[model samples]
Target chain A: MGSYNWNWPILLKEPYFGWIVSGFGKTILIAVFAWAIAFPLGSAIGIARTADNRALRLAGTVYVDIFRNIPLLVQMFLWYFVVPELLPADWGRWVKRDMPYPQFITAVACLGLYTASRVGEQVRSGIEAIPRGQRDAGLAMGLTPTQVYRYVLIPVAYRTIIPPLTSDFLGVFKNSSLALTIGVLELTSQARQIEEYTFAAFEAFTVATVLYCLVTGLVIVIMRIVESRTRIAGTIAVGAQ
Target chain B: MFGSFDFGILLANAPFLWNGMLLTLQLTALAVTGGLLLGVVLAVLRLSPIKPLAWVVEAYVNFLRSMPLILVIFWFYTLVPKLIGRPVSGFYSVLIAFVMFEAAYYSEIIRAGISSVRRGQISAAMALGLTKMQSMRYVILPQAVRNMVPVLLTQSIVMLQDTSLVYVVGLRDFLTSADIVASRDNRPTELYMFVAIVFLVICFSASRLANQLRRRYSL
Candidate 1:
């Protein structure tokens, strides 16, 4: 076996350092953009899952099942490689050739869509976890079903589910690394690129690992603050024994 | 709208995809087994009276949990071969990565499962003159495992979906097999759609089963 060299300085050097920064930026971009799509869409689907109409609930369930069951990597490939081809010819050409940051767009769409299924489940459970009496009380008070959800259900559900939503938010950041598979140049792929260029796999991955931990750690800390701040004051704490 | 798709391509590549599916199952089984075995150890250590041991285990789980699995896979794919002074096969490398990475998750689950058991059970076991190990083995673990069954099943489903990342190391898991055939036949849409359907069926059914088990066990 050849002797392995430990080179730490390479990561701090010019192009590689720039790559890491840009890659980190892209990772944040993907997560934030994906959340922008996932939050409202997921809340809507979650609401639909509990809707009185059978068709609406079924549609929501179907959406969640299809999106959640398939692996995100496969979805990434389909969105990037297959979706364009299925469109009209000119549209296909435009998506394939002329769309700006096509890979980034595809990655955001895939991650957003996939995460929505999970968030929708969380939202549905949050809504379901409310006492049955609350809904009945809302209806008795002359509120429409939609108004009941908007006024009595969604607000409480969203607050109660903040902890789980925090995890999902972190998941979006972690899953955004898959964007690299579609050529999105996210942090993980940039690590792979650095390894390819320098053959210092250990150094490259070490830096990447540190950066990931830092981001996730920061997210956790911030979320803890959010959890405390947004916590309902009067209700019994969830998961209290 | 999907009139242009040729289902024949999927039919022709059925055997290849089946083999890929088998590999996916094989990897998932190995990783889950290894992960759980190691996870049990880690969880036990984490909850042990030894503070340093617990701290080390806690750090290991936390740091690993915070990172992208693809990076971990890449790390082990390179690191394992160097550490062993031999070129490890991609399958073994990936297996190592997955077992290590998944152990963190499973340990958390196992830790929760263990904690979910009432403290009275352990005290009662000791009062019955059972050794600590015997109490853990015969009393606590049995109860914990029962509570953990549903969650373990759900994690297994996630692991199955995660097996697709083996494509990074050029292992021909189910999705990768579809990718190969898609590129070869120039039928990306058909093959990927087929891939999605297969995963959908397996995962959806398994998740439903898990939910049923969860409901049953909760009662």
Candidate 2:
């Protein structure tokens, strides 16, 4: 233990620094792209959960339950390894050999769908928290149920749920590290790579820890700004301490 | 793919998969128990009036919470041996990491639960001439535990699912066992599908139970 040397400089050197930067970029890329899928799909599922149609609600519940219950790592494996195999023989061959950035694509799809379930739950809660009077008022105004959601419920629910959504967004960043399992070579994977290449596990991980904190810190600040700016005047203040 | 699906290999590998599932369950149970115990202590320390001690505990929890659990596992997997001046088993390293990592999350939940107990309960206990420690034990914690149970169950479900991450360090957790058999048997779809179904059933039912408890207690 005493014989272990601390080598911080290697992280700043040529290839290692490049690895860190590229890994950082890939992580952000995966998280943001995944969010693109999650937000819309989750919002739809959330809306369905709150709707009057029994079948729609049941379907939404089924989707949320299945996606939320499975571990993200297993989901990642299934998407990467099993999905391609399940395709038609020629298509499977193409996915296995011809697809561009297969690992990255699988990572984004897996993470996107998984986080969608969580976002759906948050959206459901947000909508449920709205007063009964709000819905009744929309009905009295002769707005159809769909119109009521489109014009009234969704806008308010989305705003009210921003805080929880922000956390889920952060979850995506943290969860993006799992992409390393399927060889997407994101930030955590790169840190492990550096550790393997040089036995300076402490130094490599320390740098990774700092980088993760910086990204999360930046996200928190940005979300705080968004929260303040979009805060509706009379809505229930969540997390009001 | 469905027509060619191999059921026989899965039947042959059932014992192996079951053993892996057992290991996964064992890890989840140990981590949840250990994490909750450590978390309660952290929550108490953070809530205590000792400014320096509270500050230190807060920093530790926040730092751990900010990073990914996988990174924590890897760091401790590498760091513990150095600390002990000898190599340790992968299971021990992962156990240490899960307990510590989960403590941060569980502590926050416990802290919230404790805070949700009304301030008047403490005052009432004080008016009854009980000591602060006595008040906490007799008055506050019982109510806090009631509120905390449902959320704690939910968190444990999360940790149970997270136990699959043990595969990263090559420990043969449930998912890893399925993975091994899938690759060996060339039946990734069947094996992985079975793993997903197993996780879905356990976690979904657990969550439903959590929801029922929440409703029962809220009344």
Candidate 3:
């Protein structure tokens, strides 16, 4: 009992206070960066998988298979600690020296790449869900294949994938905690710091839990709205009963 | 620099890596098995006639689903030991966390599978003079389980990949062991590439098996 003391005042004071706020900022930054990178890359990979070109499909499949199978933490550590060292000496030096946010870069890159595999699958399904006649109609209207995809395929696919994409966004948000291992000061890292500084593990983690729930809750609400709005007509009516 | 990535190092460390691999598989097996059992129970609870029971299960699922796995792992590691006033091994701690975290997800999957079962199947089973429990046991469960194989396999692959996260808790799983070897030898790219390949092989096989099952069971 003596070991557990309630110290709300200490938690709110200098250093601890700044650390938590910055940690929250970093977590949001990591999630946003990861999502931004993942979406385009994943969409490209997804498009590539269904492309008529064999090589593109092969490359896309391999990339998705490899990235999706491995764990995020392992990939992050590899990128952060291993990849730079394997580079040519001068290049490695530049990377090691010039990169101020090595951990952050690694976190974002790993999370993005990992998430891209999932989003790629979602995008592929979304595109496939679109009727082939739509693409034919685009072609019939004198649009090139590229134009057809950009103008017709992509817009429809993006809209269709919104629900899955939202879940992926949440996944990236949760996975950002892996960044803490590489020493990026995210929410979980800040909690660890607070616990170390004040020995208030329970309170620090409780705060983190609340913050996580709040962010995830917000994402869920937004996704539900997007899902309902974008839902195909009569699907729910038919689904419900 | 590590002398052009010596295969000899990996060969020498093969035994250690094998141990870690065994632990990783064991962890995934235990977690998935425990999770599925707990998940089925929660799924049943979610579908129970009692409103309060269903509400409790829903809350549990939502809370677990929303929380990060790392935080859950950490919380369980700390709370379990403190509450019991005895040290739980890191291995069991991770297993417990995985089961708890995964059960929520599995419950949803199971529920979906159950719901997808046609309504008339139950009525027809009742028409055969079977009790409601007997109908579910003899008819609904088999059909749901059959249709659920592919999805469950996918979830199993996810659990396999997620086992790597246990490294954070200092468990000597494959990823942690690879990290140790890579850090010690300074050959991060080669070692991590190897680890990635191992995971790819495992997941690829699981997915292939899932596909085969899907084709076999296709209506």
Candidate 4:
């Protein structure tokens, strides 16, 4: 494992150190925004999936299938290039011309949509796992269907699904690195940049890899704490995957 | 732009794209087979009684899983040649990276499959005079594999989509070939769209097969 000079000190020097830290921050920012987008959108679609209306169910399924099937890179490119061009002329011009943080927005949207599909699956299975009587009891208590979902079904489902959702959260964090391909200059791209500049490929990547593990490990620990606290007694078997 | 769409660029470059797709399939096959072999070995070690060996394997798996696949490809691409004291092709470098990274995931799948085989089955086999390794080989893995077929297929689909990431290593995978044509003909839209369509079609079919497997296995 040690053929080259292992200069661990290089990462602490002025430019490389700042570059890596900023990249780490960007990566975290992307993950947070992506989760912000995925969670609510996924929850809505997940609710639609369990709805009695046939059209809503089909719409949810189609959204999941289309977004889930395409490779994330392709989706990123599509959002950045094809989608903007597909808009009306003035709007397209605005996207390609005057839009602020175009790459950032596109990457966030692509990641959010892509990750929403996976989260939606978790949500669907979670809602389905609740006892049928829960829905009936909510309705029997003079609540509307939406209120039943909001008050009874969704809350329970979300609690039971914390663990799986945690994995999905970690997954989105990892996938955000793919934003580098679209020229987002996130953590992985920063590693490549450092490698190109200093030829310290091993050191640069090792540092970045450690940073990634640190972030993900922290997420796992936090999620486990949340999971332990929210765990419902005797109802743990619901969507346990 | 819609009225001026031109797939002539894609049509002429069809053979090149086909070659790229073949290369992708070749890579996927090699990685899945090689990774599964390595996965079986790792899974066995993980299931073993030795704590330190299991810990080492766990760390390796968890670390790789935590990092992005693209980073792993880059890491191996830059470091492997240095370690081996010679130059290597992009294909070999990417292949090694894929095999190593996918092995972590496959080992997890295999380990879960192995664990699903009941404790009694292993104990019963031991009582019948089979060694631990022999019992796992003869009695446990066979049933575990049957239960695990669907998940393996699902993971393979994921691997297939991930093959496109090899483009970063300068490997002309399905997406890369399209990018080449797009640049050559000055038609990014048509060519990239074509690549996306091809990916969608292939991935959708594979996902359908996986869904079928899920239904069958759940039954």
Q: Rank the candidates by TM-score, best first.
A: 2, 1, 4, 3
Listed models, DockQ each: 0.77, 0.80, 0.60, 0.67
Cα lDDT tens digits, model 3, B1-219, are: 766777877898899999999999999999999999999999999999999999999988988777778888877876677666778888887788899999998998899889879999999999999998899999998888877778888898998888888876789999889889988987677778788878878888888898898788733
TM-score, first chain, each model: 0.95, 0.95, 0.90, 0.95
Off by over 4 Å in 2: A234-236
Task: Give the winner by lDDT: 3 or 4.
Answer: 4
Q: What lDDT tens digits, residue by residue, belong to model 1 across residues A1-241?
A: 3699888999999899999999999999999999999998999999999999999999999999999899989899989988888888999999989999899999999999999999999999999999989999999999999999999998899888887888898889999999988888989999899999999788888888898899999888887777778778897556310
Q: What is the lDDT of residue A41 in candidate 4?
A: 93
Q: How does model 2 score by TM-score? A: 0.96
TM-score, candidate number 3: 0.93
Top-TM-score structure, candidate number: 2
Please state the interface RMSD for every predicted structure, separated by commas.
1.5, 1.1, 2.4, 1.4
- Residues B1-219 of candidate 4: C-alpha lDDT, one tens digit per residue: 687788676778889999998999999999999999999899989878899999999999998999999999999898788878899888998999999999999999888887788989988999999997799789987878877778888888789889889988779988888878777877778877887888788878888987787777732
True contacts kept of 1: 0.90
Descending-DockQ candidate ranking: 2, 1, 4, 3
Query: Runs in model 1 with CA error above 4 Å?
Result: A235-241, B120-139
Worst 10 residues of 1 chain B by lDDT: B210-219
| TM-score of chain A as modeled in candidate 3 | 0.90
Instruction: Extract clashing residue pairs from model 3.
Output: none
